[model samples]
Target: MDCVKLPDVGSRSLTTALIQFGFVQSYPDYSLFTYCKHNVRLHMLIYVDDLIIGGNDTAAIVKFKSISIGASIYLGPLKYFLGIEVAHGPEGIFLSQRKYALDIISKCGFLGAKPTSVPIEQNHHLALAKGTLMENPNRYRRLVGRLIYLTITRPELCYCIHILAQFMQSPRQEHWDAALRVVRYMKGYPGQGLLFCSDSDLRLYAYCDSDWASFPLTRRSLIGYFVLLGQTPVSWKTKKQHTMSRSSTKAEYRSMVTTSCELKWMKKLLLSFGVAHDEPARLYCDNQVALHIVVNLVFHERTKHIEVNCHFVRDELQRGNIVTCHVRTTEQLADILTKALGKEKFAYFLGKLGIRNLHTPI
Candidate 1:
């Protein structure tokens, strides 16, 4: 099969066939196809040549596997897909990148290094460090790229990975060492992964927070969000704002807007799975000023300096898509994604995010 030609032609043909078979393409995610007939529903997610099919109807799933596409093979139950290791048990579905993470650790030659409790040191300023750039920066770029992929099952590494990724264009020794420290931390818990609890509710909620002007060089704030379907983390991100935020409220408000958009997307994605998310998703923010800006209509002057699109939060708020709520600082779970934390606090939030090691002995 020709690499370039196969993907375009094969995917287009498969997509056309799936559509003709009464499968509706997901609006938010085109690669996903959903089939809903009365109470029976099926969802197929396309990843290049791979197809992951799931549904509650056993007969429908069997019928899907026997499609006319003779080239498609049924891989029975899913134990491993891509780099992620999936395990099923009474606790629910456990997703991990144990092998992928270990490979990265070995690649960095940190297999014998001492493990740290936290991924990064608290208040550590990585951007201000000035030094000679590495001669061969591709190694650092490749390693950081791998670390970014590992975040799929390890959301706790999002902030540190985000910081390290910034230096990809011109990596220095300090940045390299910081990246190694993250690798060492991952060595401590190679098996740690997110667990989807069997008894978890279907309710969706999210936490959004920002570190105002966290980047000293650009004066850009760091925004991080974690969205959970019940207690299972479905989506999370740690990104630096494109533009500088003058006030902490604006930084936090921008964070809320990003999270609101993700929640709306999640709602639509759930619809593809036949899950009706009619209730407003709960949006938690520790900043009172930001929460006020979201709920109060008279706060226009304060947020006038903010980007026009940032007001999408307000539209979603009034449309009954999401409800902004004030959460105390101590209870903010998304804090881990915005900045580093102490060993104890970091561990506390990790447990709340449903990160665990299924390989550990009870």
Candidate 2:
């Protein structure tokens, strides 16, 4: 009956029982588990009782299902799980939360509102925007929370949500208004989501970008990176850096370090899933100076002030674990994450990231 002690107890008990059955975690994270037994390979992702199992051998999966869980339903191919709807075809699988998005819009009472072309305005900046406090902060908090979860399938919402989340403690009218704008933007195309194309070759490629000292209040740069498995985007993060960077190149190199960590973990994860990418992952950057600092030995006096941790990306390059390639600033898909873009630029980057509308024919 105690809530605090229950989760830890349940996790330990579940991990112990699963490990006994030959299922081992990729890391200490009990949520992810894999079991390879007698050519019957199985990968199970467990979040409490919700289990998503996948593998090459269906016989092994069916055998495990019969042995455990007692009751089972085979959906053949994964069409829906959690809140994401999957559309699988010859091209690949498309994941969408269109209905979930619509539900958010309807619940927020923005169903009749005019949809915006961009989530946030191109020149709009929300920094300590002063306005009267909302009568009910709880409603704003709850709405922002729902929008935050939507970033899983909707990357465009990342920056907007990140900005709005800062005001949860005391949401003002301006904050509420900004949050509503994001909801209205979502109304434009509720079916927009990521597309995993089968045509993409099995290679690891990542793009990293930063908006240096863009935050008006903190002056800390925003770091953003997205990793692509072949052409399918799997992981992404848009976060403001913790500390200030003396130079733009330092900010970018810092972003590269953050992205490299993700690439390393993804490689290990793919290996467990039977995807072995022996080649070094390609990392694209729009800043030529950052790439120069990474590949060249001479660290300028200006960049020497950068923390030692940021140089790990340089080490990764030297060791052949990654290759830094130059990409045009206009073609930098990660640009959307670092700053707000207009309709034309936003649409271009959205297409580049392989996120498209999985619109159902009306």
Candidate 3:
């Protein structure tokens, strides 16, 4: 009875401890913080109990450990945090989960399988009835679940994992094979990860696109979008529409709606994180009709079925939260999230997404 086990006690304790140590919560609400007590500045990232402390000042970190309701837990040099391997140098930090990727490859038994440049084969369509049912649907479900987590660093798997996740409740043999192919693709660059360069531009830019009627039986389109803070991707999603779109323009416009909302939130986040990006953020889409709809505001038969909520995109465009522009399909970053691609096209997009292998010599 001496110790009380109450809801949020852990969070409260951590918050109280951090403030006592002069660390101010910054990003993700309370997950990341900055400390500047006694002219020593440092940044600390807290993932529950695990912590990653970083800064040029080593003494500030030692002072953080001095306030002891808790013991100092030094995991050392910040190589791995929350399953992401970090390689820090003069250039910047490179983040990867090579160990996690290898574990997924082993669990799915794709160790010796042939590797491919792309996660999904070109024009590969996975329908519900296309393959026979697997005896254990959980097996397929688990593999897809790992792929979903893997997408944190491996965005190329977004479309592939999104497709595989759909059949989790009743996975088929085709789904199993498709999921395995993604694992084999992971084998090609098991150490692939993102690089956040020290000298890269911080201006926010985004690429969004939609694949028209990619789902066969449902006839619903896939929406894909990725927001880049400089050359690094910060936010991305690949999801199937809940309702069917009447035309390619409608699908693409819907994708814009989602991306605009994400951009709005990201803007607010940047300001909260102590970096204000006042320059007009650039949002690129492959569909000209979609960009035109936001700028021109011409209502017509094609735009009739679009819900009222979707018009927030137009509102944001007017306010200049972001500027919508058209890019070619080949250069669209969201393409990786919308559909499968050929080896050459896939490799092109993969590199463009800032995914590089840590094992390779820089």
Candidate 4:
């Protein structure tokens, strides 16, 4: 056998510092680190700075450490990492980071602020000229930035975040107030977050909707979607359409096209994981014209304004890769993100999105 040289202690510390932080355990007799990959067992043995990791089972490493190190080692119950708080309960695994929200609120000097019931006022049309200009735009920008990050687990705030994000270049006093409204809303829903269950059926279902010419300044429509795996939401988005839509029907069709592309990608990904869908994926849209456009092949004169790319939904329908169905406006999951809603309607849609008050035990 040939002799191999290992790196010194200094080199090991440098390598660890360069990598993302994780637990490090040292055992004299244990030859390697072990972990599971794709539900298969694997192991790695380390000798000083050198390591060798693999195998079917790692009982030898555990037994060796038990005899030589006189201690039993187990991996982790690591609940929180990278601002994502994790909790495992009988219902499922709940994930959120309320502490991070508090930090942002305090940093923005809104800790003692009064709570607001709604994030954005109903029937209030925010324009580019509303409210006095803010002297320090950076503070408002930072606050909105933090809130955008919070949307990862708080889909309820997606609309508010999108509106505030637009004013980042020149946030005014009114924009700051709107930002605070969201923060106050967070204060009330501190414990609220997302839950993923072991019992959930991994079905790909999506709902897409758009608000026609919702942005007064740009005359651009807002397109939004909510993708669900069974009853739990897995992905969502609220974005201003790049081109101005001529009518609500055109806007809704554009949104459907976007959702169809997402479903197609998801179908391919699911196939790679060996999961097959019994039926074509379903997409819910509130607009009847858009649904008709998707199912019908002929293009009418009214649809000339729609871009060619937006016609992909028709192809997807032809391929039997997706089925578009009509959902009532009240039941549209994307409605919350596309436009401002009343308190009752907002709460109703929130419930529809699988969000619940965690403070009152499920």
Task: Assess every candidate by TM-score.
Answer: 0.94, 0.92, 0.90, 0.78
lDDT of each: 0.87, 0.82, 0.80, 0.73
For the record, the alpha-carbon RMSD of candidate 4 to the native fold, in angstroms, is 8.9
State which candidate, 1 or 4, has the greater TM-score: 1
lDDT by residue (56-136, candidate 1, tens digit) is 788888777766663566666777777888888898989999999889988888888889999999878789878779999
Cα lDDT of model 3 by residue, 35-98, tens digit:
7655556776666667666665666666555555455445557677667787887878888889
The TM-score, computed over Cα atoms with residue i paired to residue i, of candidate 2 is: 0.92
Q: What is the lDDT of candidate 3?
A: 0.80
What is the C-alpha local distance difference test score of candidate 2?
0.82
Q: What's the best-to-worst order under lDDT?
A: 1, 2, 3, 4
Q: What is the lDDT, from 0 to 100, of the residue 61 in candidate 1?
A: 80
Top candidate by TM-score: 1
lDDT of 2 by residue, 14-66 (tens): 77767887888877344777888778778877655456777768787766666
